[model samples]
Target: MHAPALALGALFSATAAIAHLACIAIGAPAYRVMGAGERMARAAQAGRLQPALVTLAVAAMLSAWAGYAVSGAGVVGPWPFTRPALVLITVLYLARGLAFALLKPLFPGNSATFWWISSGLCLLIGLVHLYGLLAAP
Candidate 1:
């Protein structure tokens, strides 16, 4: 199995998931630092559920993506539709990274730093996943 690249991709996704969960636990400051916008931070500070709920949903999806990567790597038992799932995940990350420039207007609340860092990370992870999948026997 093509283990290395997929393993790295899994690691990246899992780390991001953990970070998202941490933002929820850490509250307003975390939200702001993560470029989640002042509105989200205010909602978090106000004890509204929206920020936490949205963060949780994102974290859960990231975790699932990590699991798919691990499954593709043969690091665990095969998950259902592992190959297809990996392809989709790869495409998702790549698309997100590549489209970030055009999508800036759509996400005006997020900081430029956030966009740069996130886009770079997504591109890296997407490339790793692509390499792993392509190298698979």
Candidate 2:
């Protein structure tokens, strides 16, 4: 079942989810440091709920992705559409990583540092997922 690679992918996703949650708890500076964009940071500083809410949603999604990965690894009970979910997650991460340069224009306010770091992390996670898929019986 390619347990190792899938487990690694799950770990990465879980870590990312934790990071997103941390950004919300740590407030504006955390948002800025995480390359969440100045708008989000400003909104956080102004005590608005939008930034936290959005970050929470992202964290939840990442957590779900992690669950899927773990399920594929057989570390957890099988989830509905596990194979398809893994495929979509892998594709999304790879695309986001590979297209960071192109995506920069769409998220103009995000720092270059953010795009580069996040893209690299995403690419690594995607590769792990791909390896797991390829190794599956």
Q: TM-score of each candidate? A: 0.97, 0.97
Which 10-residue span in candidate 2 carries the lowest summed lDDT?
A: 101-110
The best candidate by lDDT is 2
Count residue pairs with overlapping backbones in model 1. Answer: 0
Scored by CA lDDT, what does every candidate get? 0.94, 0.96
Over the stretch 23-113, how does candidate 1's per-residue lDDT look in tens digits?
Answer: 9999999999998888899999999999999999999999999999999988899999999999999999999889998988887888898
For candidate 2, lDDT tens digit of each residue in 1-137?
69999999999999999999999999999999999899989999999999999999999999999999999999989999999999999999999889998989998889989999999999999999999999999
Instruction: Score candidate 1 by TM-score against the native.
Output: 0.97
Task: Please estimate how well model 1 matches the true structure, expressed as its whole-model Cα lDDT.
Answer: 0.94
